[model samples]
Structures are given as C-alpha cells and as structure tokens.
Target: MKNLRNALLLKQLYQLKQLGYKYTSVTPYKEDEQHLRLPNTLDSLKKQAMECHLCELSKSRQKVVFGEGDPQADILFIGEGPGTMEDSSGKPFVGRSGELLTKMIENVLLISRSEVYITNIVKCRPPNNATPTPTQAHTCQPYLLKQIELIRPKIIVTLGVTAYHYLTGDDTEISKVRGTLHKQNDYTVIPTYHPSYLLRNPSAKKEVFEDLLKVKELMGK
Candidate 1:
C-alpha cells in the first residue's frame, strides 16, 4: 500500500513538471559569455547572482542577494523577492521582516536564523519593489532550482503567494496554503505569509507561528 501511494505521488509530481508546474532548471544563471566560477554551494550562488544577466533585473540591481545561512541546514526559507534593505545590503531579509523571521526561526526547533538558509525565488530586487514578471522568473528560476538541489534541504518554507505560486502553480490563497505541507519536485514544501505581511497585520503572526511549529515537528525538533 505504501509503495502504491508513493508511486501515485511520484506520478503527480511528474505531471506537474511536464505541465511546467514544478521543474528542475538546468540552465546557467546567465548567458554572460563570460563564465564566472560558480561555487557548488550557496556562497558561490551569491557571486553568480550579482553578475547574472539572465533577465533585465541585473541592469538596475544594486546587489543580487543570492542567499545566506547554514549551507547544510535542514530547513530553507524562500521568499518572493528582494526588498530595499535587501538590495542595499546585498542580503536577504535584513529588515524588520527579517527580524520577525529570526524570532520565528528561533521559536521553532531551537535553531537560529543563521542556522537555516534563506533566499528568494528571484535573486535580484525587482524595480521599486515590484513583483517579478513571468519572464523574469523564468530567467532566474534555474538558479533557485540549482540551489535547492545542491542544498538538498529537508524542508522548504515559501513566504508569500508569489513564491508559492511559482513553485506549485496552484492559485490557492496563502491562507489555504499555510499550515499544510505539500510536496514539490521531491522537496517538502509549506507556504506561509511573508514576514512583512505579518508585520502589517500582527494577527497573522498566529498563523505564521503555527506554520513554524509544523516545520519544527517535521524537523523532529
């Protein structure tokens, strides 16, 4: 029975990939024609992300925050895109939202924020905090996929509708997505509201915290 269920699950995942839902991107992050040595780890991803011209974002970007945190972390947090502070610092989630994320991370599993990898679906900061268009996402996605495959994280926590949408292609609302674990490309995925969202609506923290607890349980922490 377990084997049958597993087969069914694998079939569904393949269907999603075939339909351009969840996929493993193999393309380089850029077509620079000037190859930069990409590190096999997150640290190297940052270097490539900065020089990446996979999309027009590189043209106006101040910094392409590749990612940060423990490379071998069991947990990975993926966000929608970079914001002002992130761009300025060339780091992901360094603002108030990052602070909230840090606290939430600590609350779950006794792990510090520095102990888990944090990145975004799109590496570069979108113009004026705008959302990443489909074309941009297409260009940047391969890099993210590479990161996931390299880290082989045990859990992926997507923060916001955009990240969830691109990963699962299900237009389900964030409220519906949060607190429920989903599998994508063989990774355990759970979507939740962006920390920035929780800051605006503190009531949502309850929901975010609950989601964190789920991650804790999954980690056996």
Candidate 2:
C-alpha cells in the first residue's frame, strides 16, 4: 500500500536523522523487509540505543540512560530528558525530582517504583541541563517509539510540556491538560507536571497528586 510505504519512509528518515544525516535518498523496500529494520526485542533495542551516536547530545553524554523497570510494565513514565544527576548516574529520575517521583508512585499509585517502566524523550543529557532541541528530540524519537512497541504499556504518562508535546505533537500548555485522559493509538495517555517542576513550585504538588489519583483509578487501584 502507498500509505504503508510512506510510513516506512518516514521511519527511515527518523533513523537517518538520528545518525546526524541532514538528507538522503530512500530506496523503496519490499514490505517483507520493512519489519526487519526495527529490533524485535527490548534488549536488542536498548543495545542499539546504547551505541547510538546519532545526535549532538551523544557527544556530551556519559551514558545512554536507555530506561529501566519491568519489561512488561503496564505503565510507562516519560520525562523530557536526562538531568545532571541522571547524566552522572546513568538512570532516569534518580535526582531530587526522581525522589519525588518515586514517592508519588509508591504513595499515590500504591505501587513500587520497580513495578513500572520509566524513560525520557531523549536518552542522552543535553549540555547545561537544557531542554533538547527539536532536531535532537526528533532524532531520538525512533528509539522511544520502538520501546513503546516492544513494551506495549497500557498507560503512558507524559511528564511536562516537552514529553507531552513530543509524544502527541500537541503544543498545548501542560496545565490545561495535566489531569486529562487522552486516547492515543492503543494506549491511554495522561499528561502531568514533571517532578522537577514540583521541586521548584511545590504548590503544583497538589495538582500532580490529583493526576496520580486518576492514574490509580484507571489502573483499578
């Protein structure tokens, strides 16, 4: 189908973009070969990500921070990208913000942190803890997409405007949709404030609490 071919081309473009290629010509592929391009397993995907040098962030990163948690988790939390602590420790949400997130998960969701998966929009850390540029995010998106496909999480929580915007291609302010439920493909998406935001603006904690409650309700907790 033409639509399928176009979609396949788009995926290849993302891959090329990751490799820091500005432009390239794509040859048509037989449908059978299309599936072979993506790694079929999470381990393989993570391995691919670990060795990735597709974007500028890779130049400054200490580790890939590919993500961690139960392989078949029902919920996945996506943040913007690695911060100073995360960059140094090679883990997601391991800083002050991470501590808050852990408490939110355990206390509000009534689940252990290890029970769910956690990752970021981009695996590498941006210099000076700045937000990832559009090119950087676009390049790393394929990896995240593959992770979602392999993990097949039932719910995806997009933390902050960056995660929400990149995942849904919607630039709406996070406050307006913080606790809203959205159907995206086969998964339920819940947008909420990043824990780092809570650290700076503790007043927002109540709103995040409400959002987590919704997540709990959806999970039948």
Per-model TM against the reference? 0.81, 0.85
Q: Flag clash pairs in model 2.
A: 18-54
lDDT per residue (tens digit) for residues 1-221 in model 2:
14334444555676678899886776744576554365779999898889887677889999899999998999999999999888888899996899999999999999999999999999999999898877778778888888898899999999999999999999899999899999999899999999989999999999999999999999999
Give me the candidate number with maximum lDDT.
2
C-alpha local distance difference test of each model: 0.79, 0.88
Best by TM-score: 2
Q: Which stretches of candidate 1 lie over 4 Å from their true place?
A: 1-39
User: Can you write out model 1's per-residue Cα lDDT over 1-221, one digit (the tens) per residue?
Assistant: 12223323444455456689756554322323234234576666666667677567888888888888888778999998999999989889988999988988987658888889999988888899998877666566667777887888989999999998877778899987788899777679989999989989999988888888899888887
Model 1: clashing residue pairs?
none
How far is 10's C-alpha from truth in model 2 (Å)? Answer: 8.1
lDDT of 2 at 65: 94
Pick out the ten consecutive residues of candidate 1 with the lowest summed lDDT: 1-10
